[model samples]
Structures are given as C-alpha cells and as structure tokens.
Target: MSGGGFSRLPNGTVVVAVSLPSPLGDGSVARFLVHAANRARALTRLRNLGLRAVYLRGNAEPPTPDEITAVLHHPDGLLWRLQGAPAAELWHPFRSSSPLRNRWA
Candidate 1:
C-alpha cells in the first residue's frame, strides 16, 4: 500500500491517503485507517514540495469535522505550508460554511 489514494474535491483541493494493505478482517480495516493517519504525517513533509493537502479516511466515521479542523489549524499543519501560491489546498469544503466552487480555483 504505497501508491495511496487521491480524492479531488470540487474546490480543487486534493485529499491523499496512503494505501495500506488490508489484513483480512475488521482489524485490517482498522489498521488501514490508523496507517492512513500515520502516512498523513509523511505526506505532510511533502508540503514543502507543493503537496500540502491531505485527507485521512481512518474509519466509517470519516473523521469528525472538528478533528479535521484541528489538523488544518494546527501550528505545523497543512495550512502553514500552503502560505503562498501553488500549494495543494487540501481542505474539505463540505464542512465549510461556504461551499467550494471547484478543485483548482
């Protein structure tokens, strides 16, 4: 599971997740989710290279809106890396008060 998955939002933000191998049962899915978040950290490092945005699908819950907010607003979060132009705006517009118009605006 290295190729990972990509979800391009309507706002132009790209949500990327690591593709961890599923074990065989419920535990597999759970571990995949955990690994997804763990891999998110690795992906964060790529922000400096124009890969700032990511989305973690760790479980059926799809991560809380607040949890996502915390990640984006964290001191060293993705937002910090997307300061200028060209950074991948990896934010979820569905949770925002105003919806996004496209994925590359």
Candidate 2:
C-alpha cells in the first residue's frame, strides 16, 4: 500500500503536487487542484499523466466558494529544487488486493 487511503466521496477537490524528474539534473515540482470523487481517483489520474512522483495535499469536501476561487484565481506555481522526492507514496487504486478495489468497481 502507498500511504493511507482516503474516503470514497466524489464531492471533494484534492490538491496534488508532483515532482518531475528533470533531464538537466535539477528536479521540479508542480501543484494542481484536481476535482475528483476521491483521493484514489485523483492519484490515479495523476499517474495516468505519466508522472512517477506525486503527492496529495489538502482537500475540501463540497469545496467552499473560497476554495473554488483560490483554485481558479491563484493557481499554484512550480518550485525548482536540487533534491528531495514526492512526500506521498504512489499506489494503484484498483489493485485486486487494495481496499479501494470495491469502491472503484
């Protein structure tokens, strides 16, 4: 298992930050606000984008008006760094042995 599983609710928005392996030897991290049914789905989507290192940040249930504003108005910027990896572990949400299997099914 990669980190903890989140509640299977589709009415929330999760903030995801991913670290892209750089070819220049300098890594970069980018943040995105994703709207999904749950954190598992969010992680899955991020993985589908071909990112190997992803992390889940804060989330809001039934996102508040302010939260929406923040996502739309002031998007997160990428951070350049020399080292360090994503904070969260990456796992398949639909693995047969995963607790989230039934939830996705």
Best by lDDT: 2
For candidate 1, report its TM-score: 0.24
Model 1 over residues 1-105: C-alpha lDDT tens digits? 223343333565443433332233332211111112344454654433333343444433333343344444544333221112243544332212322212212
Candidate 2's TM-score:
0.35
Q: What are the lDDT figures for the candidates, one per model?
A: 0.33, 0.37
- What TM-score, computed on C-alpha atoms, does each candidate reach? 0.24, 0.35
lDDT score, candidate 1: 0.33
**Global CA lDDT computed for model 2:** 0.37
Clashes by residue pair, model 1: 1-19, 10-102, 10-103, 11-102, 11-103, 12-102, 12-103, 12-104
- Badly placed stretches (over 4 Å) of model 2 are 1-28, 55-105
Residues 5-81 of candidate 2: C-alpha lDDT, one tens digit per residue: 22332345443333334444334322233445556666676556444455544432233343334443443311122
Error of 1 at 8 (Å): 0.3
